[model samples]
Target: MNLKNNIETILGRPLTSDELNNINQFKNQFSIDEDDPLIVVLALVGANKILIEEMPKLLQQKANETIDLHRQTLITQSALIAKDLIHVVASSIDSSKSPIQRATPYLISFFLGGLSLAIALVLVR
Candidate 1:
């Protein structure tokens, strides 16, 4: 694990000559070995920096994914409800049945549709 290369990849750029000099000076002054625990700390600090830089974008992306999933769910539910309503309407318009009996299916479908809408509104909130 080359720390310099790792940091450069995370940053999407190479360190400047001055930055390299600084790192060399710090390493020499501390007598830090390549396998030192300090290297782990440095890597962690680099990771934290990248996370901070990309936090907002990451959050927005997650939010968008959630919205898209909800939208798809709503669409699927709506389609299913529409199909149910169509079936109800078809079953309700029976010429052979009495008026009251014919109206029963429509009333039930309307009630169910309203209930579905109410549930959907509640879920959306």
Candidate 2:
């Protein structure tokens, strides 16, 4: 297959001298066949097309991994908050009982001391 004719047929135009020179340079640099540079060009183009097509999916997978990591971090933070809240509530409940329990004994002792003083005064009278 004539490379120049094939390129002109595909492009629907005549090749410029510069374009032909560039193609010749590319073929020589890559050691492509003299008969058809189209095969090498097509292979390179196809590989680039595949990489372009798969880019979005690869980016989406990376995005999913990032999202999952963020979700796990949030869950762990929520659990820690819940644990701290539970500790606060338990301490409040314990402190609430302590004051009343301590006050009850002091009140009972004061009542008994007043009654004893009143009985001694009545006997003296």
Candidate 3:
């Protein structure tokens, strides 16, 4: 493949005149022909540089996605656990208990669930 064409294909655009001149100068300096196998290596090195420059952003995006997923999971788990606790508390309450006593467990469960969700949100950030 033509080195200039290959590099342009990889970059998704045609090279500038200055870029073409630089390639030509390098080839002349190294006594390298246009069809030399080293042209392929040069094109690949250029592609590698582009990929390396983009790598950190790609990794950070994936990391953010993973963190969001974990946060959602934590919130779901907290809500479920709180619901189950409320059910257990309600079932265990005595029928003879006062109205305030019967409502206390539910209030506590809701508070704990909210606290857990807040913690998960903070951790994700």
Model 2 CA deviation exceeding 4 Å by range: 1-41, 95-125
lDDT by residue for model 2 (1-125), tens? 65555566665667678767765666678776856656646445434544576699999999999977776665555555555544544444533467777565455544554454444444433
> lDDT values of the candidates?
0.72, 0.59, 0.77
Worst ten in a row by lDDT for model 2: 116-125
**What is candidate 1's lDDT per residue for 47-125, written digit by digit as tens?**
5665686799999999999998997788678758866885777675878999888888777777777777667767765
RMSD per candidate (Å) reads 6.5, 23.9, 4.0
**Model 2 TM-score on a 0 to 1 scale:** 0.42
Q: Which candidate is the best by TM-score?
A: 3
On residues 1-125, what C-alpha lDDT tens digit does candidate 3 reach at each position? 68889888988888778777866676688887777899888887765665687699999999999988888887787678767766776688777979899788777767776676677667656
Model 2, global lDDT: 0.59
* Candidate with more favorable, higher lDDT: 1 or 2: 1
Q: Distance (Å) between predicted and true CA of 8, model 1?
A: 7.7
Candidate 3 regions exceeding 4 Å error are: 7-34, 98-100, 119-124
Candidate 1 lDDT for residue 49: 60
